[model samples]
Target chain A: MISLFLDTSSKKLVVILVKDKEIIGKKELESINDHSSYLVPFIKELLDLNNIKTNDINKIFVVNGPGSFTGTRIGVTVGKVLAFSNNIPVIPVSSLKQYIFSLENYDYYVSIIKDKNNRMYYGIYDKDYNDIVVDKYQTKDVFLKDINDLKNVVFISEEEIDGIDTIKPILNINKLIDYYKDKEINAHYLKPNYLKKIDAEDKL
Target chain B: MNEYKLTTRCEEDTISIAENLEAEKFPGMVICLNGELGSGKTVFTKGFAAALGISETITSPTFNIIKEYLNGEMPLYHMDIYRLEDNPESTGLLDYFDKDGVVIIEWANMIEDYLPEERLDVYFKVIEEDKRIIKFIPHGQKYEELCEDAL
Candidate 1:
């Protein structure tokens, strides 16, 4: 069975195809702000180069972001369209958790996606992949206020933050798919996991 | 105390002033522009971008709200906050100040609260067709120095 991965949450346009939890094809391009135009073409390219037909894919793993407003929505829309049309189950993954799965160090792991106006979308998890605290979206000042002194808390992210130390994430797709394989839901129920509320949330 | 005023008779005069400012461009420079419609805000931006060695046709980012030009000699982040007033929760607006690029905002008065402290604010007053009275207010020492030489 074929499983496709789609993530455009941050600056990158990431697409990976996994067969039986092993990555067979992937495209990870950095600093692609124009995800809407590049996403579909890259998906086709990934499948064509791998000699895998889209019909063969049984399920899809999509990162519904806590990242860029437009970039995340484009990825989510494509994933939803593919799932609903193909009648396949879609797994909605968090953009923050994608960073979390990249590390196994420390008792607690923090995955953060920094946004506009000194704000961030952060997820904190224990080693068991259980939430230590619910995911949040707030200014960096308010979020990092009391957590800076914790020794066991490790910050994991791909992007650099001012004055804050961060370790780069190495995404383990096999572990990711293994964790969310059975958590698939109907395409209609799928939505972008934007932790923060925006003015156009009710409209868009 | 760091304010300067100039009167321009035509579009060329405005373009010259923009190019003069662009000649002294540095990373992380924020230029706040305010004026009524047709007061040469976008025209000034185009001149500045052109002087910065961007070949692309520069246009107002009213619809896009914010547009980034990375192909230029320096990264140029252009924004128009006219329509953004309706949606005040627009995220990441101030983060551009630290991006090591030249950020020019049109209709900048709309987001006066979010404007950085170390920046240049230019207000345009239309005197007549093809004529404008421009006022430059430099906030901080860096911008004060910039205006002393460029304006």
Candidate 2:
């Protein structure tokens, strides 16, 4: 099945077009909050480069939240609208989960995204793919203490720290190809997996 | 889509309305307003002044690009970008955003190039003869909470 993945949760905007387990097209752009302008055009560019059309796409994956509020909304809104219009299944992928999945050979991993409210969007998971989060968001003090108490904890995110071994950012296409290829993963159930509420005027 | 529409109407003049609304704000907020040229942008500033508890008179700093009113509850940075040109390379009048106070920029469309990724984008336009429409959109979680509380 042809699958398309779009992630705009952070500073980097990632777009991947995958045909089953293999990647056919990919595009990346850097902008503060230019998601609305680039989203549809990036999709079109990817499709054109791969000689593929929207009609050939069977599934779309979108990163839901815990990142830029505007970026998350733009990506999800586009994904939802396109999926609904095309009658395709959409897989919601969490930016944090994708970050964790990027690490290689790490048993225990901690993922963090800055919430900018003196707190963090953080969680814990192991190679077994189980969450160890008692809370999705924790204050800086609490998060630091929890990290200090834990052993074999590798931080998987874009942020770098001295005590914690940092993992590079990983795209959802790479994770999907490595982990979900040939696996029985549900498409409709795929969601952003956010621990904290996204702040936006609509939500208010 | 539930089709939710919320309109905040005040019987008082623009200054009083803005002041009442300003009094209900929190830090790290994004405010979007929609009104016409003479529809009370400056009058709204007076309300913001009252909300910030500023004793000074609020005026339109149209030519100055932005003005700071810091002697209040929270720092109030008011801006008027009407004189700004709509060129992406110009960066417009975004230098006002880096301050510590709640930033309010008039004529946002003039500097769309430099708008924060997470901010409140207010659209101000005139509706009827004397009515003004102010549409507020909070881009991030911080602003969302502020909007919720303000509502």
Candidate 3:
């Protein structure tokens, strides 16, 4: 069985391919504003480099948002199209959950993604990767206040957050594939999890 | 007594400032917005709401007086005190200061006497069809640091 995972939830574009539970090829690109233009071609290049045909991919896994709105949409849309065209199963994974999957060793882990301003998208998880606090946006002050009483917490973040024991989390593809082997959803129902409303729609 | 001035070229710029300011938000934080009509006060509020993980559409509270959004990272108590010029006390507006939520008051100048001492005041001035000059006045130490961090 072959599975492909794609994540465009941040400034980085991550693509991973696995065949029969073994790692094959993975690509991570620093794509800031060019996700719409570079995503499909990048995916093709990743597959061609590994000599893996598109038909060989039996399932698709994608990080569906709480990050950059456009970036998340681009990856989700691409995954849905590829899955629907090939009649393959699609799995929508939370970028926050993926961060937790990267930190299974910690007894308590807090995953954070900085949003515009001092606000952040955060989630708290246990060693089993079960979410203790679901993903939400809050100011760094409020987030700290909420976690002030918790003991032995490790913070996983892309950037440095002051006054916290922070570590840069590495997303392990093998662990992720093993963890969510049965959580595939239909391609027709896949949607980006924006977690907030767009500015244009906020008017009276 | 610290003041910060920002010139925004468009609505997006105004919202960007608001979103940035939202990152430093804390419970019982009060933001006082003073601006003329169509001066992007609601735009700033909308940006702040979005940063707080609010999914519902945040409209101006002109008719409602005060609108509460409890689904965000923290509750957001939005107030448009334009109609409260004559009867500010009737609405129990000051009670929100201790609600453990972020409070944003539009046309806040009208209720000057009811405002807390340690609030951040933003005044918007229209420069062009799309341009705005916003001034941030921090009334306390926390707000002053917030201005420094956000600007």
Candidate 4:
């Protein structure tokens, strides 16, 4: 079975194709802010380069973000469209947790994706792989109030990778593929686990 | 009030030096980048962002006051205080400083009081064509350690 992953959360467009725990093909264009103009063609090119027809792809994985709101929407929309058309299942992974999978070994990881409203998509994961949201996606005050003393917190994100005294925000897409493969889980709708609350409240 | 001097070729080179320094510096630390306009302050910031693994484009936050990049392995908060000339005591800008991330401030000289006393202060001065004199000063123990590491 073959799987295709698309990560268009920020300035970069990351696309990867995997088969049986190996990366068959991959392409990354850094700082491509024009998501709408470039994403579709990038995917088409990836499929063509691999010589794999869209129908040949068994599953599709996409990093549903807590990232550039527009970028997240475009990437997810494309992933959904492709999956639906090809009759393939879609695995919507959190762009933030994708950071956790990226950083291989650490006692604990604190992943912070960008929140344009001046906040972050923050979470924690222990060495045991048990994840915890210290402060769910919220702005600066909430993040600071929740995490007062920074001890054993390895903040990870794709942006501002230098500021945190902890780990880097490099997302490892291969680990994610291997994870799903071992679990025998084919493509599924893995929604983005963003902790952000939409301002619009439901009917009272 | 304290100072350490170093030579750099260009703006990006300044960032590379800052990046290497930040890689070994302490967290929960506040480092200020102070310089005159066009003195390569923002360029140095780009290098620091690169060190943090931020692959996104880095530019001066002169108008925005703060721009955070999370595209790499760490969180980088880029702040420009040039706009603070209007109101140094404004609440929103100060609040930005209170966020959780590594912050690099341009025109830090404009809003001195808004900054933490215990911070890293980098001073940039243009010497001649394509030459800059950069100084790193640590305010407290943490910043001092940062200065040592940056050295």
lDDT (Cα, tens digit) per residue for candidate 3, span A84-191? 998989998888778666554567878888654456788887778877888876667777876877776788888888777678877877778878778889898989
Sort order, DockQ high to low: 1, 2, 3, 4
lDDT of 1 by residue, A1-204 (tens): 789999987778899999876788888888655778889999999899888877778888899877666667888899999999988899988888776665666778888876655667787888777776556776776667636656777887677988878888778988888788899999988887765552243223
Instruction: Report, for all candidates in order, the number of backbone clashes.
Output: 2, 14, 3, 22
* C-alpha RMSD of candidate 3: 13.0
Span of 10 residues, lowest total lDDT, candidate 4 chain A? A195-204
lDDT (Cα, tens digit) per residue for candidate 3, span B1-151: 7789999998899989999999998888999999999999999999999999999999999999899999999899999988765555344465477467899999998878557778999999999999999999998888999999999
Q: What shift in Å separates residue B44 of candidate 4 from its native position after superposition? A: 33
What's the best-to-worst order under TM-score? 1, 3, 2, 4
Best by DockQ: 1
Error of 3 at A87 (Å): 1.1
Query: All candidates' lDDT scores?
Result: 0.82, 0.65, 0.82, 0.69
What digit string (tens of lDDT, one per residue) describes model 4 on residues A1-204?
889888887667888888766788887888654677887887788778878899898878887776655667677888888888888877766666676776646676777765443556677667654566543666566666555664555777655733455456675667776554343223345444434452232111
How many Å off is the CA of B95 in candidate 3? 35
Cα lDDT for residue B94, candidate 3: 53
* Model 4 misplaced stretches (Cα beyond 4 Å): A114-118, A145-153, A159-164, A180-204, B1-151
* Stronger candidate by DockQ (2 vs 3): 2
For B1-151, candidate 1 gives per-residue lDDT tens digits of 7679999999999999999999888988999999999999999999999999899899989998899999988999999998785543346565466566899999988877557667899999999998899999998888999998888
